[model samples]
Target: MRAVILPGKKEVQVVDRPKPVPGDGQVLVRMRASAICRSDMSLYYGGKPLVGGEAAKTGTIIPGHEPAGDVVEIGPGVRGLQPGDRVAVYLAIGCGHCTYCLSGYLSLCSQWKCVGFDVDGGDADYMVVPAQNCLKLPDPMSYETGALLLDNMGTQYHAQKTLGVSGNDTLAIFGLGPMGSAGVLIAKARGARVIAVDVLDSRLEMAKELGADVVINSTKEDAVEVLRELTHGEGVDKAIDSSGNPAAQNAALDSVRKMGSVALIGETSATTINPSEQMIRKLLKVYGIWIHPIWMFEEIANFVIDHNIPVDRYITHRFNIEQAAEAFRLFDERVTDKAVFVWD
Candidate 1:
């Protein structure tokens, strides 16, 4: 079996490895589709993965957290799923006895481990995961779409729901990366008027095609001013920042109307904000959004199917395991908006 391993900086390797077998309560899935994400860049660059404590520090685990495939074998204690089941493996594995895990908030559990970062992942031809971590993928869904459901698409879906985005609201999204692009699709599906902001013309163009009501070029134009003007000078009703860039984050905060809500989905370090001005003065409601709880996968998938949201629109490149080097290179260089590794 071929597997992708990032041993260190600027290196991508597809090495031959033994195919894994399922252990108790686990299932071995034959990998079908996996998506490359911006977060994977940390591992691609030889830096430690964002999760997985000591395992991530070793820097040898397969580097894909967004994966979906077909079940081939099930170990003892596995139930309700069998061979031929099409599923997307939720990335986090938590101590099942914990309250957070019991509530389906696996990522919130104290003893959570990430699949691709902490153990072998779907970057290989076969990988084993706890049966409980597998989310069923509907027959109508593509493997690529299934892979994205846990991360990019699901994150935006959770964020918008948190802010209660609806037809009555005007939403502004900063950053047009895949996450931001997903936000546009979800916001539009909810009937919100969407204003997308980005520095790149390519991304802003793609955002428009994905149903963004208005697109603002932050590099060439003033995104805040454009957002205000589009909302008839009242500012948008809600804002989301997916860039994690400080300037874009601040602009998202400033572009929304007083009392308007904002969701910060992107990960960033310390970003200075005036408490009195950005929070108190505006009476803003701000949410820090990470990947969603495991239970939300069903709702997100149904929403995707119900609204006919085109998840494939976010993908711009596809590769095989053998092309691991070039795949990460293009993604790292920002030449591809969203890239997937597809199996035969």
Candidate 2:
């Protein structure tokens, strides 16, 4: 088997390794597609992982959390699944008995381990995962689309569903990265008037392609002011900040209507904001959304299929596992919005 490993400091290695056998209650999957995420850059730079335990800092684990493939073998004790099952692997490996795990919020489990971080991931020809973590892909969904839905699309779907975004509301999304792009597609499917904001014109263009009603270059124009003007001074009905930039986060809080909601999907260590001015006075509904619950993949998949969302359009680059180095480099430099490793 061939696998990719990031040994820190922007180093990428594709090495040959023995194919892993599935352990009890596990399954071996033949890798088909795996998407790169911004958070992966932390490991690329040898920085502390954004999510995971001490094992993540070791950088010995294969680095891909968003992946989908076909099950080739099943381990002892596994049930209800078998060879040839096409599935997307969930990123979190939880202690099943915990309250959070039983409720399907695996990532919230105190003893959770992150795939691609705490353990070997799918950035290879083959990988093994617990059987419970496999999310069966819809028959029609492509492998690449299945991989992307695990993270970017799934996160946005969960956030917008929490916000109750609909045709009656206007949504201003900060950051036109893959997550934001997914936001645009999902918001449009829900019939919302979408306002996309980013510092880069290329991203804004992609947003427009994905059905944004308006695109704002925050660097050239004040996003909050423009959002207010577009809403006839009432402000957008809802806003989401996926940039994690302090300025954009504040703008998301400021650009919503008095009782409107905001969902912060971006990962950020710290940022300053005025609760009094942004939330207290307005009685705003603010939510901090992370990945969707493990059980939500079915709903997310149904929604995407029902709405005919162009989920694959979110990917801008694809590479064979052998091109792992250049793939990570381009993604790190922001040259690719969504990059994936694919197998024939």
Candidate 3:
């Protein structure tokens, strides 16, 4: 197998590697499509708590998590899934017995381990993951779109769940990145009036197509004031921060109404953010969102399949597995919203 490994800061290379055999309760999936995520860049550039730190150090890591593929082989003790099944693999393999998993918040499980981040991911010809973490793809969905259903879209769904946004609420998403764009679609689907914010005009235009009622170019306008005026002096009912930037986080806090919820879904490495003023003045419900639970992936996939969510619109670029380095470069430049590495 050929895999791209990020050995150290700003280092990535493709090399031949041995194929992995699935252990008990695991399934070996022949890679089909895997999408690069913002968090992947963080790890590649030395983010804290690197999931696959050891593998990365040894120069053998394969970084990818938003993977969709077909099961090529099943290991001992695996059941209910078999070879040839098309599946969207869940990256976070949480310990099932943990208190967090038992309470249905598996993303918060203390012993959670992730693929692409914690182990060798799907950026190669094949990858191994636990059978329990795989979600069967609908027959009609393309593998490229299916790969995103579990990870990217699922994150948006979870953020909405946290903020309790509904048909009657007005929401503002402070980023037009892929996940935030998905939130706009979901929010509109649920009948909320969505305001999307981004510095990029192209992304703001994309957000409008995805159903955002208004798009703010934050580089030119005060996003908070814009939201306040749009909401008639009361801020939006909910605001979501998906830019993973401190400024965006602050904008989200400043754009929501008193007592309104703010959900942070993007991965941020910023050590300090002074939210005390906003927290005290607004009595806000601030949630730090992580990756979503597996069950949400099923529900989100159903929504996408049933309602035909325009998830494919987020894919601005596609590359073969050999183009992994270029994919990461584009991601680094923020020139593309989402890029997928195609294998089959």
- Best-performing candidate as measured by lDDT: 2
TM-score of each: 0.98, 0.99, 0.93
Q: How would you encode candidate 1's per-residue C-alpha lDDT over 1-344 as one tens digit per residue?
A: 99999876878888998888789999999999999988888788876566677877676788788999999999999999999999999998999999999998888988898888888888889899999999999989999999999899999999999999999999999989999999999999999999999888999999999999888888889888888888889899999999999998899888889999999988887798876888789999999998799999999999999999999987999999999999999998888888999998
> Measured by TM-score, how close is model 1 to the native structure?
0.98
Clashing pairs in 1: none
- Which of 1 and 3 is ahead in lDDT? 1
Give me the overall lDDT of model 2.
0.93
Worst 10 residues of 1 by lDDT: 46-55
lDDT of 3 by residue, 141-251 (tens): 888888887678888888887777898899999878888878888888777889999999989998988788899999899889989999999999999988888899988
Point out the worst 10-residue segment of candidate 2 by lDDT.
Answer: 47-56
State how far residue 111 of model 2 sits from its true place (Å): 0.3
> What's the true lDDT of residue 103 in model 1?
90
Residues 212-241, candidate 2: write the lDDT tens digits. 999999989998899999999999999999
Better of 1 and 2 by lDDT: 2
Q: Candidate 3 — which residues are off by over 4 angstroms?
A: 47-53, 56-58, 271-276
Off by over 4 Å in 2: none
